[model samples]
Every structure is written in C-alpha cells, then in structure tokens.
Target: MDTPKIELTKDGSNTLVHPKYNAHYHSTAGAIIESDFVYIKSGLDFFIESTQTNSVSVLEIGFGSGLNAINTYRYAMEHEVFVEYIGVEKYPISLEVVQQLNFLNFFSIEDKEKVFIEMHQSIENKNLNFSEFFNFKKSFQDFSTINSLNQYDVIYFDAFAPNDQPELWTENLFSKMYASLKPNGVLVTYCAQGHARRAMQAAGFSVKRIPGPPSKRHITRAVKI
Candidate 1:
C-alpha cells in the first residue's frame, strides 16, 4: 500500500490522505475534535453513563491513524475505566507516516508519545495489555470479514464515507454490525446520510441522528435493542 500523506488538520493534529482513494482519514476541520465528538462522547461516554459499567469493549471499523484508539485509551485512563479495544484496518498506516502525526501534542501525560508509538507498533491480531485498565488489539483484516457475535459493547464505525465506499454502508454490513453488538450496544459514525440511517434500521438497530462535530450537521448513533 502506498504511504498516506500527512496533512495538518484545523485543530493542529495530523490526518492522513489516502494515496489511491484520495480520501482523508479524518475531517479536515479537526481530527481530534471529530473523534472526541463522534466516538468518545456519542459512543463511549454514552455507553458508560447508560450502563454504569466500568468495563467497555469497543470495536473500531477503520483504524487508519490510530487516533480513535489512542483517544479511547486516554479516556479510559482519565475515567479509571477498563477498556478492551479491537481496531480493524485493512491498510495499516506506515510507521514512518505515524511518526509524523502530532497527536501527542494535544495530550498531557507522562510518556504519552511512547504510548502512541506502542499503539502503532503493537503486534496485530494479538491482544496487547497496555495496563490493567486497557487491552488493545489490531486486526489487519477487512470489517466485512468480522463474524463476531454479540461480542462488543460499542462500535466506532469510522469507515470512509458512503459515497466513497458504498458497499460498507449497505444493509448486509449493518446486519453484521448489529449481530456483533451485545443487546443495547451502540454504533456511532460521522456519516448521517438518510440511506445509512435506513440501512441501520433495516439491520434491526434503533437509529438516531445526533448533533455532529464541528463543520458537520449531524451524526448517527444506532443501538441494538
């Protein structure tokens, strides 16, 4: 795979633009802000508050830059929550590209840069226990190949846009996601298209359109009920 080009987001964090697809790994306006709003607040925080659970198992669809994974880890540490993060990515970014990202600048923790490096360097498909509170694993596989059943509490569906990858937004894939989630499990995505919402609904999820991050009007949150 061609190495993605690093570009500075509006929030001063780096986002990768795919060489072939010409799509960005995150919103150009702000990478960190987008992840925080769409995945952390809308998905992780909501799950924690609603279930009152100290442990959360999250499956992320497109672990492009590892931004979502690192942010999730940070959230777990700050809240004293136990997090099991499974990130799936077909095209893992080159470490050289990862080294260029400025994600650590937004964080304030001892050796946070090392933690970020560890996230990228960790072995794929094998669980890496970063701490008693955090377990992480990266799957170098496509999301459609995931056949897990009732295994996750939340999913960060941060795949490329539907217009860019329409097959990923289909009802068939949404059905798989619905099956992967435990009852009441939530799936959050930045895509708020009507067809995507209908796809989730057709897959048996209770879909809701929530306020989006900066520069976007709305996002989708679907629950397995």
Candidate 2:
C-alpha cells in the first residue's frame, strides 16, 4: 500500500487526503466530524428515524475512511436499532489511515477513539454481526457489477462527484442501484447535479433536492418507487 500524504486544508481544521482512489475526503466546515454533516445531519438521519424499521440494511457507494459506517454503527448502538451496513469501495484506505481519522473530535467525548478502533477491528470480509445492533460487510469492488434483488432499505450514494467519476453517476449505474433497492427504499447523496438527477429519474427513482450542510448548497434524495 502506498503512503497517504495528508494535508490540512486552508481552514486548518479539515484533514484532506488524496486517497487511493484519487479522491478527497475531508470534514465539512472545518469540523472534525466526517459523516455527521454528510450522512447524519443530512436527511439520512431523519429518514432512518421516520422508517422506524426494527432491522434495516444500508448500502454505501464509497466506504472511503469508513466514517459513515462507524457513525452509523455508533448511532445504532445508542438507539438500539439493528443495522446491517454494507460499504463498497474500489480503493479502500489502509487501516492506519482510518485510525488517524479524528472523527471523535467532532463528537462530545474523546474516548470514542477506542470505539472507532474496535469498529475497525470488527470489520471483516464476511458479515460480522455483533452487539445486537451492528452487522457489517466491507467489500472492495465496483458497484455496477453488483447484482442482487432489492434488499437494502436505505442507500447512501457517497461516490465522488459526477465530474470526477462520470461512469458511476450514469443512468446505467443508477439502474443497477435501483435493482438493488427494495420498493420505497430511499437513496441519499451529496450531489444535486441536474444530470445526476435525470439519470436517477431514468432509473425509475423519484428524485428531489434538499438543503445541504454548510459550504454545500444542495443535496439529493431518491426513492425506489
């Protein structure tokens, strides 16, 4: 594995890195929080709450630093919600890089670092269900090739911007994702591009734009209708 060159962005708080995928991952608004702003504070948190499913499955497009997965697991533990987290990443970051992430600084307690460490250890090739709240499967593969009947209740399309990875944002890709979603399953993403919305619509999803976090103007949500 190549060593990652970590750089502090101009804000002096966000830790930006050129990951193995030639993409960047950083906290929003100079906050050490990772998935909080993108995955939690956004409508995803509310979507999960509204669904009120006793056991739910989630599919993540880009695992990146595993921030979203970790945050979701922590939230499930706190709420006693049974969650199955499946994250897909073509280029996964090394465990060392994930450990260096400062996600807990954005939270109330620094002791959460230990929890993150345990989360990393918990991730394995096969689904490892534990704590009665978290079950995870981390895969290194392209999402387009994945074929499965509609199963997941929620989908987190956290891939890089369409400008960078146009293929991943295409109508064809969205069609595949649509096939992977159960009826009424919702998909959330940080992209609000017109073409992206059209592609999702072309895949039979009902799409809508929503307010994003600070620095980001808009986000998107789609439902498998």
Candidate 3:
C-alpha cells in the first residue's frame, strides 16, 4: 500500500487518507472530535461511569495515526484514571509522516507534544508507562493473530468502514473481539451497518445504535454479557 496523504479536517485537526481504502483515517468532519466523541467519551467514559473505576484496560484496533490512544491518555490524565492501553496495528505509519501530521497542535499543554512524539518513537510490544496515568504498548501485527481472552475492559473498534475493509467486519472477527473482552465489556465503533450489527450479535454481543459524532448519523456499541 502507498503512504497515506495528510488532510485537514473540519475541526482543524489533521488526518490521513488511505490509498487503498480511499477513506480518511478518521472522520473528515473532525478527526479529534470523532475520536474524542466515539472512542473516549462514549467508549472509555461510559465504561468508567458504569464501573466507577479509576483504572481501565483498553484494546484498540487500527491504531492508524495514534489519535485515539493519545485522546485516551489525555482523558486519563484529566480524570485521574489509570489506563493500560494496547493499540494493535498492521501497517504502522512512518515516524516521519507521523511527525508531519498536526496532532500536536490539538493539545494546549506544552508536554503533550513530547507525549505524542515519544508514543510514536516508543518500541513496539514494549509496555511503557513513563507518564503517571497511562501505560501503553503497540502490537505491530495483523489483527488475525490476536487471541486475547477476557483481557480488555473496553474495545475501540476503530478500523476502517465495513465496506472499505469488509474482511475485518465479519462475524469471525467480532467473535474474536467478543472473546478478547471481559464480561460486561463494551466495544464502540463508528460503524452502524445492519450487517455488522447482525455479525456482532452472532458473535454473542448485544448491539445497539448510539449517537455518532458530527457528520455521522449513528454509531454502534456492543457489549459482552
């Protein structure tokens, strides 16, 4: 696959457009808005609210530009929540390209720029918690190889659209996700297609449609019970 090109989103954050998928790495309406809304507020905050826990374990698919992870870490710091974040990605973007993106401008804190850089520079498969609230690591492999069982408190199913990457949205993949999450764990995504919901249901998840971010109608949230 060719390297993705950077584009400015509506909310002023930068995102990448995949060559093969022909889709933006995040919502074109607003990269940060979409991630913060769908993955952080809806996914992580909902989990925290339901469990009333100061610590959380999160597993994210399609770690793309690391926006969602950064947003999660930011949320953890602000809320005094400790997070163990595992980001899974198959094709890791280059550090050069990562540096070019304007994700740094999204943070008002002076240290957050360093945080973003260090996150990309950090060695893959090595858990690092240099910060007070966040422990993070990346798995640089195909999602199919992952077989974690009851390990995650929340799953950020942030892969490309169902049509763009149809293979990843299948029942088999959702079953793996169901197994990877603990009981009562929730999976949130920007997809709400009927077939995807059915596939998730077939995999034992109770699926529901929820309000999406700007420019999106509805997203999906599924739970393992």
Candidate 4:
C-alpha cells in the first residue's frame, strides 16, 4: 500500500490514486456518482427493497477517503433508514487528507465537515453512533482478516482492481465473504471480471452482471445462496 495522491474525478469529486496499486481508488468518471449507483442503489437500496427492512448492516472493503461511508450516512439520514456499517481499511488515510475532499458540498446537512472529519478520525474497532440512523465502526485491519460470519446484509466490495490486489479477489476470500453475509445478503462491486465472477460462484454465491455507472459497461452483484 502507498500513500494515495488526491485527484479529481469527472464529477468533480475527489479520488485517490494509489501509487503501489497503480489505480484510482474510484472511477475516473466519477467517485460519488459511481458509489451512488453501485453501492447505494444496487446494494443498500436493493437490499432494503427486497427485504423490506428499515435497518441494514453493511461491510465495506477499502474505506479509502471515507467516500462510501459518508455517502451511506447521508443516504440514511435522507431516507430515515438505520444503517450499521463496518469500514475496513488496512492503511487508513490521515484526517488532513480527508478534510481536503469536497464531499461535504454534495450534502445539505449542517456541520457536514465536522461529521465527516469525525468519521475519518474515529477510533478503530469501537462502534460510533454517528447519528440516530447511522452507526459506524472503523475496522482497522486487513480485509483478509475479516471474520464476521452471517452478519452483514450487504457488502460494498470497493477494493482495488484484481490486477492491483489479486489476493483480495479470490475464491478463498469470496468464501469468507459468503460466510460473512446472512442468507441472500448481497455483495456489490465495481468489478465485473470473469475471474471475480467465477470465484464468487465457486464460493456459493449467485453472481450477475448489472448495468454500471457512467463510463463503465458492467458491475457485479453476488448474492449469498
């Protein structure tokens, strides 16, 4: 892992470019927009609609820049949904970098900067009640060490690409992910690679390709069977 340098996506949102991975932390087309389509609409909203549940638990791999976390928190506040999120990041970014992002401009809430800063700087492993509807915890560890079984309703697999982080996108890891989710729980990711899909299928998931965000052809959503 390397210190990711900040860059602007097509949607004018900030994203980080990892030198070691040689990849953008998010899509070059858009950061927040991509998250909205893949993570929020496909994962969170889809789970809520299918299960008719007011509360949902989510596991996010590669919590870089806290982009997805803040987006999820904002969504929960807007929709009055209760969200319990676990954000896993082995190499956490500094609060100084987090503050440089323009994510707060996307929301209308008061003290958005303060809230976002707090989330980025939160203590690792301890649950933080961020709001009435959103509870967050920063799991300061490697994604491979995740051991939560049959726990989360949805997973935002936001890790780097397979070519960059091959170990994270494997059958063995997918098996763990399958075990980490409740029956029928889903895992959504920007990746639609054949290897990833096969690995998910091999791990007992029902995988499918769905329409992607702008500038992308497809993404994967794997469901626990």
What residue runs in model 3 are displaced by over 4 Å at the alpha carbon?
none
Clashes of each: 0, 0, 0, 0
Top candidate by lDDT: 1
lDDT of 4 by residue, 1-225 (tens): 556789999999888888776789889899989999999999999999999999999999989888898899889999999999999988888776777888788888755777788778888888888789998898888888888889999999999999989999999999999999999899999999999999999999999999999999999999997
Candidate with the greatest TM-score versus the true structure: 1
lDDT of 4 at 217: 93
Select the stronger candidate by lDDT from 1 and 3: 1
The candidate with the higher TM-score, 2 or 4, is: 4
Clash pairs of candidate 1? none
Q: Candidate 3: lDDT over CA atoms? A: 0.89
Off by over 4 Å in 2: 8-15, 19-22, 27-34, 41-43, 107-124
Worst 10-residue lDDT window for candidate 3 reads 103-112
Q: Which residue pairs collide, candidate 3?
A: none
TM-score of candidate 1 relative to the true fold: 0.98
Superposed by TM-score, candidate 1 places the C-alpha of residue 12 at a distance from the truth, in angstroms, of: 1.2
Candidate 1 steric clashes: 0
What are the models' TM-scores? 0.98, 0.85, 0.97, 0.97
Query: Candidate 2: minimum summed lDDT over ten consecutive residues — where?
Result: 26-35
Alpha carbon lDDT at 28, candidate 1: 97
Candidate 1 lDDT tens digits, 138-203:
888888888999999999999999988999999999999999999999999999999999999999
